[model samples]
Target: MKLDDIKPDIVHDVTGTYCPVPIAETAKQIKEMEIGQILELIADDPGVVEDIPAWCSSTGQEFLGMYEEDGEYHLFVKKVKELT
Candidate 1:
């Protein structure tokens, strides 16, 4: 499915926040989500462009991809592994 076509189970808005905050919040929110569920992280931090995908890869999650909208980024991440 297209990245835009996928609806997120959770939408975490970290706009106006800086690096680490976006990634930090994403990490926390994903823990409360179920497997296969998608998390849509809305962040304005440029760091998220690299951080989100890297974080997903390292954490064994699916980095679905991202898109920019209204000067903000919409990062799509899917939960693949359960928190231990």
Candidate 2:
């Protein structure tokens, strides 16, 4: 299924947060969720440029994709099985 089609079981809006903290929290949420779950992260922190991708790489979660809508950057990830 497409990234958007996968309903994120967990939604995290860390717009005001900064650095790796927000992305780390997103990863943490994913870790605590059930296998094959989805996590939708909406982060405004520019650090998300590196944080999100880094988190995905380290956790092995599927980094489906990210896009900008209106004035927000939306990141979509699927837990798919487990964090490899």
Q: Output the number of the lDDT-best candidate.
A: 1
Q: List, residue by residue over 7-37, the lDDT tens digit for candidate 2.
A: 7778888887777678778868887888777
CA lDDT, every prediction? 0.92, 0.76
| Per-residue C-alpha lDDT of model 1 across residues 1-84, encoded as one tens digit per residue | 798599999998999999779988999998999999999999998899999999998999999999998889999999999865
Give the Å error, residue 74, model 1.
Answer: 0.2
Show model 1 residue runs off by greater than 4 Å: none
RMSD of 2: 2.2
TM-score of model 2 vs. true structure:
0.80
Question: How many clashes (backbone N, Cα, C below 3 Å) per candidate?
Answer: 0, 0
lDDT of 2: 0.76
What lDDT, from 0 to 1, does candidate 1 have? 0.92
Highest-TM-score candidate? 1
